[model samples]
Target: MAKIEPGNGLTSAVSRNILRGTTESLALTDGEGNSFGSDSELNAYTSERQTDKYGFIGGAQQYSEQSAENIPPEVLRQREAKWLDMLNNWDKWMAKRHKKMKLRCQKGIPPSLRGRAWLYLSGGKVKREQHKGKFEELDSQAGDPKWVDVIERDLHRQFPFHEMFVAREGHGQQDLYRVLKAYTLHRPEEGYCQAQAPIAAVLLMHMPAEDAFWGLVQICEKYLPGYYSAGLEAIQLDGEILFALLKRVSPLAHRHLKKHNMDPILYMTEWFMCAFSRTLPWASVLRVWDMFFCEGVKIIFRVGLVLLKCMLGSQDKLKTCQGQYETMELLKTIDTRYMQEGFLVREILELPVSERDIEKEHLASVRRWKETRGELHCKALPRMHGAKAIMAAEPPSRQDLRQNPTIIVELPLATKSNGEDKERKKTKEEKNGKKNSSPTPVVADLEPSKPPPPLKDTALLGSNQSLSSTEHDTYL
Candidate 1:
C-alpha cells in the first residue's frame, strides 16, 4: 500500500490510480459478484435489492449497509458500553464527561446507538417530549400548497443513491414528506426550503419520522437557524466568513480563487445549507453530523475550510486550473478517496480553528455584509435575488421560539400519594357544610432534596430523562 502524505498533490498518475483502486474497493456490489460502474447503477441495484428482500412497503436499505460490520469488535463493544453508560447517567455524562463524549463522537458513534445519541446530543429528546403529539397535529393539516410541489420534486433527488430514498413512494420518502410538511406547519414563516430535504433524509436514516422531525427542528432552530430560512441571509453572511477564513488559512488558494473572480456562493451554498450531506461520502457525513450536533455550526465552517484547502491548497493542482470554470469544476468534483472518512475526520479535528475563531469571523463578516448592503442602496443582496427574503432587515423574531420549544422538564405539581388534592376537596366540603371529613395528613416531600440514585446496569437501556442545559452548554 502507498501512503499519500498531506500536502502531496494527487496529480500524479500513480497516485490517482491508487486512489481509484481504493475507492473501488469500497464501492457497492449487486450481490451477484457484480459491481456498479456508476452512481445510477448502484442506485438501481440497491433499489432492486430492497424490492427483492423487503418489497416496496418498508424503508429501503441505507447507503452504507456495511458500516457497522466494518468496525472492529473491540471498538464496537467499547462504544456500546459508553453509549449505555451515557444513557443511564445522561445528565451526569453530558455535564461531566463531555470531553470524553466529544472524543468518542470524533471516533464515531456506533450505528445502532447513533439515533439515540443524536437525539440526546441535539436535545431532540427534550424537544420531542416537550412537543408530544405535535407532529400528529401538524400532519393532520395540509401545508401551504405553494411548498407541496417544490418538496415533492426534490424528494427523490436527496440521497438518490441511498436505498432509503430510492422509491418515490417508499416508506422513507413518505416519512420524509411528513417530516418536511410538519416542519412547514411548525414554522410557517420559514416554510419549505430545498436544502432541508437532504438534511431530513439523512435524519430519517438514523431515526423514525417523528424523532427525525424533532431532530430537524433542533438543527434548524438551534444549530443553523437563519441559514435555511427564506432569505438564506446567514448562509450569505457565512459565505463571506468562509472566504475570509480561507484567505487566512490558505492565502495562496484564496488568491487563486479571487484572481479568477470566483465567489464563495458559487460553490459553498449547497455545502453550507446541507451541512456537507451532499458533498461528503455517506460515512464521512455521519461522522461530521456527530460533531455538528455536539459542537454548533462551527463544525460546518471548519469542515468547509479544510475542504477548500484540500481542493485548492496545492500549488501544483491550482497551477493547471485556467479559470473560474475549471476551478469550480475541480471543486465540485473533488475526489472522495482523498477524503476517506477516518482521515477527513482527523484533519477536521486537528484544524486550529475554534468556535471563538468562527464567532470573530462571523461578526466581522456580518459587518462587512451590512456595509455592502448599505453601498447597494439598501437593495436586496445578490444572494437574495432568487430566494425570497423573509428576513430582510431585522433580526429573526421571537416568534422563532414558538418553532422550537425550550427544553422543559415538567415536574408534577403534587404527588398523588401526598393527597394534597384530597385535602383541598375536604376543605371545600367543610366550608360548604356539606360533609364532615377528616383532613388527609400531608406528607413532607423530601424527594426533591435527595441526591439522584446511583446509576445501575438495569437502568441503562430505558432512560427517558431529558438533560438540562447545564449538561449541554458545557461543550456545545
Candidate 2:
C-alpha cells in the first residue's frame, strides 16, 4: 500500500485553475526562465526524480525500505491467459458471457493488455473504426486559438510527476495536447476541459494517441456525459446522488458532512472528474479505471462512499473531525491504509450500491433540483452501463469487425515456352517408336519467376503516427 499524498500541488492546482480560468502566469519555466519543450529538458529533469513502476516521479521507495504486495507470477500468468482469450474473442464474450468479462475486470486488467482492454470495454474501438481517419482529419486542421492556448498551459499540469508528463512538450504532453485539441475541434461547442487532460494522459499511457482520443470521446459522450461541459451539471447531479447515498450507507458520516455544510463538490470534483486518477495510488487508480470503464459511474459512486465510510463512518473516526476544517483535512489526507488497492477494491465491491439504486437517487435528485433550481439546463442523454450494454446498444458491424483486413496475393501460373513444348512432343513421338526425332535442343523452361508483390497493410497508411511524426510536432 504505497500511498503517496494525492495532492502534490500538480493535480489540485491545475484542476482548480482550469476550473476557473487559464492565465499566462501559470506557464512553468525552467531554471534559466526558458519554457520547457525540448527532449533535453526531459533528460535533465528525470535525473533529479525517482520514478515508480507506473513512472510517477518521487513515488518509489528503495527495495530495502519498501513493503508492497506483489502479485505472484503464476497468478499473473493465469490472468493474462484469461485476458488474452477475452481479447481475441471480445465480440463473442461481450455478446454472450459478459459476466465473465465483468469478473475479470473487477479482478484487474493485466498491465500489458490494459490499453486494448480499455478500448474494447469503452466501445472506443468500434467508434474509432466507424469514424476512421476522423481524428487525423481533425488533428490536421488548426485548433481554436482560445482552446489551444488553454490546452497548452494545462498540458504540463497533468501527471507532471509521472515520467509520461515530466517533460514539457515531451511525447506524453504532445499526445495529451493533440487528444484535447482534437477533442475541442471535434466538439467545438463543448470546447476543452482541464479534467480531461489527466484522463487522456491515462489513456495514452495504455494506448496511442488516436485510441486515446476515442477513449476520451467515449468518456465525455458515453460514459460520463455533461461532466466536463460548461456547468458540469452531470457531475453535480452525481455529487448530490453520492451525498444522498451516503446518508443511507453511513448516517454518521453523512450527518457529519451535513453539520459542516460540506458539499460533495468541495472534495469529489477531482475524484469523480478525473476518475480518481489523482486521488488513488497508481495501482489503485488503474484498478478503479478498469472497473469504471466496464461498469460506468456506479463504481465511482461506490468508491466515494467507501472513502466517506472509512474517514467518518464510526464514532472513533468521527470524534477527531470537530469542524469543517478538521473534516476536510481528514479527507484531503486520506489514510493510506484505506487506499491499499486490494482492500479498497474489496470494500468497493462489497458496498452493494447498484445501478438501480443510483437511478432511484438520480430521479429523486432531479426532482429536488427542479424544485430548487428550476428546469435543468444541461440534460445528459441516457447511457448504457457496462461493456455488454454498450456492445448491445452499438453492436459493431462487419466493417467495424474487420479493422485490419489481410491481403493475399495469388501467384501467376508457370507456362512452358514453345521450344520446350516441341521438344516434349518429339520425345513423346520417339518413345512411341518414331526414332527419326533428332536430339532437339530444349529451350530453357520459362516461369513467371517474380515473387508476388509485397503485401500492403492499408491501415498503416492513415495511422495516427503517420499523420504527424514526433519530429514535426512543434510545441507552442
TM-score of each: 0.67, 0.78
Worst 10 residues of 2 by lDDT: 467-476
Task: Assess candidate 2 and give its lDDT.
Answer: 0.73
Candidate 2: tens digits of C-alpha lDDT, residues 130-152: 89799989989889998898888
- CA shift of 51, model 1, Å: 11
Candidate 2 colliding pairs = none
**Mind sharing the TM-score for model 2?**
0.78
Residue 350 of candidate 1: its Cα lDDT?
Answer: 81
Give per-residue CA lDDT, model 1, range 162-209, as digits (tens).
555554465666778889999988988677877788789888777777
Which consecutive 10 residues in model 1 have the weakest lDDT in total? 384-393
Q: What are the per-model numbers of colliding residue pairs?
A: 0, 0
Task: Flag regions of model 1 displaced more than 4 Å.
Answer: 1-69, 375-476
Q: Name the best candidate (by lDDT).
A: 2
